[model samples]
Target: MSAWDRTTSREQVLTRIRKLAEIGKISDTGVSRLAMTPLDRQAVELARQWMKEAGMSVRLDAAGNLIGRLESPVAPDAPVLMLGSHLDTQPYAGRFDGIIGVLGAIEAVHAFVSEGLVPQRPIEVVAFSDEEGCRFNKGIFGSRAMVGRLEEGELERVDGDGITRSEALSIFGGDSARLDEAKYAKGSIAAYLELHIEQGPVLESLDAACGLVTGISGPLWLTVELHGFAGHAGSVPMSMRRDALAGAARIIAGLQDLVRAEAGTPAVGTAGTLQLFPGSRNIIPERVQFTIDLRDMDMERRNRLEAKLRELIDEVAADNGLTYSIREDTNSPPRYCDPELMDVIRLEANGMGLQLPELMSGPFHDALALSYACPYAMIFVRSKDGISHNPQEYSSADDIAEGVELLYRTMRSLALSIQGERSGGKWESTTA
Candidate 1:
């Protein structure tokens, strides 16, 4: 606790998390604050107040991102050092999934200014919109928009409630038509940093409270649809049945075997969602739609498995007398963290008497999108039982403080090092 005395306050960080958790509270610890909803806006306003109290000029960008700027007194026009994650949560998410990152960043900047230290480059704390993407089925909306990586027809995407993304943005105080204006210019961000829960058991199993991320293993998202003839379940003979759900089930089960083939590797796949048309007890399923999530640290291996998966789908569809189609929703290559930035983090952690285990993140974060715009890195706090995206997700306050303290120290060091002159609004790299 005394280690955090110089900068971050463990109680303050935990208190804020508790308050935010009550906004969309469900069961005991579950939250359902989906993006662009009234609850999400309320949460943003609360976070906005905290940012303002931390001495930042805040605004909501055209892309629905809430940004708090702490302009450097020395180089006001220099490229900024950005820190943040998303505020929106999954339908049945825990409070700490994306909450700690935003609050920890605010705490870091708050402590920095309180110490009377001024940065060379401006620093911004952002709560990016819709990183969960559960509502619109497209995650990282705000980050992608800022990096100028948004896909075509993104605004037209609809949610389950039939609200278009354009409409949601407008209602959330953003101008959908002006999203292009929200893009940060090339080199506008000197670097990006984020803190998040491990969402896996690796850290806990290794007896570590905090870890350094080596990189993010990108996810390949796909939606597969199978169509076949429908008939009475009991009347249709098993051999003559044309069952789409059966075909889907086989593909989903086979997917597990396919990824398992690459034993001892980080390769993995999941069919987390599925829907059967005419879902009646006695009706043969005529259509089935499901989602596929595949990930691997090695792209070549992932690609090889993907080909095998497609072949499995083809075979299943043919044997079931079904026609199938696979739609690629997202295909992102793995993005590695900056080595120099990792050195900065490692040095800071060492000073704090921490030996953080380096690991690759299987779940993508806002940092994944920021990677395209500038150098990016991440710090991970240990998750209890490695649970996330669910009500039971938990991280100890002590462990979180350790992560935040490290983040504060790393940010402070980087901010001070960037102090000096600027070249065409971009600060020169000091860590040669």
Candidate 2:
């Protein structure tokens, strides 16, 4: 335990996260720091200041990823051991969703400095921007830029206010014209580790403090539009009216049933957003557009489920005498955590007497983008009631502290392993 003041470190981490939460405070407890917003910039600046205070060199990448680097004294040129997550929040989001991972990395670095210890490999903490995709309808913007996966046309995509992503990047101090510079060369990152709250109930249900993520479920987002005919609500009889909203409602219910029937598997579906044209009490909706977000750890199963959904939508639309169109907005494949890193995390959890069950992440994360650049892993602390992306989402302070401690230990172990391999020695286990 290298003389690390656990209590003080925990307090500091919590205090910083709380301060950032205030930047975009909504209502009594929600957060709304959308990507590239003024509050988002404030949060990034605050994180940069904290990184500097922790004695790390800090800078923003071309895509506006706030990076804090702690160079290793023994192996400065070794591939960087990266630690990060996003800072942007969903509309009225919880405080912990992406905030903890970035701040937790900083706390880990501060602990090393406080203990007069320099890791064997450099550690870099990154706070990625626009992970929620709330404004631009595209997630993992900064991370995709880092891996050179972002297409140039994506910059032209506009937000609700008709602001292009390119313009938003400029506002965030990121030059989309120079986005290529943000790409990391292959093998430059040794591994990426992120700590986040389990936005699901698995951990809390099992009475566990934290869990090691096995993989992140990929999502396929589709905008389904049903077109029928608008009619006077009182004048059109239920049997004669071809109401698009009614047809959409039936399809949404079918989707829920489909997922429920796929029990024992990781498959899930949601009709998160629905809009009705001619939204009036006196008129039947002629057009209904709804978003379907389906996810599964198994790609095959996910695809199968998607096919079934398409069939259901078609059948429902036909039965209701409505025309239907389905457009795939985005598709991200499932990403598995590195098995070797999973082993390291398991060993540490057992050594610390922490309950660390393996779990799959239903929500997508920045790690999915970073996976293209390097091996990645995630640690999830228990979220109360398995809730997130809302004001009620909560993770206890003690649970978050445990997660931070695990992250620190994992980074330290990886650093040492990299150093050992460089010195003509086999990597040694860091567990007792």
Instruction: Write candidate 2's Cα lDDT for 32-98 as tens digits.
Output: 8999988999999999999999889999988989999999888888889999998999988989998
Model 1 bad stretches (over 4 Å): 1-8, 223-251, 274-290, 311-327, 419-432
lDDT of each: 0.91, 0.89
Best by TM-score: 2
Best by lDDT: 1
Q: Write the per-residue lDDT of candidate 1 for residues 1-432, one digit (tens) a residue.
A: 222464238889999999999999997889999999999999999999999999999999999999999998888888899999988999999989989999999999988888887797899999999999999998999999999989899899999989999999999999988998899999889899999999999899999999999999978999999999899988999999999999998999999999988987778899999999999989999999999999988999999999999999999999999999999998979899998789889988988999799889998899999999999889999999999999999999999999999999888878877633554433334544
Displacement of the residue 10 alpha carbon in candidate 2, Å: 1.0
lDDT, residue 82, candidate 1: 94
Supply every candidate's count of residue pairs whose N, Cα or C atoms clash at under 3 angstroms: 0, 0
Clashing pairs in model 1, backbone N/Cα/C closer than 3 A:
none
- For model 2, name the residue pairs that clash: none
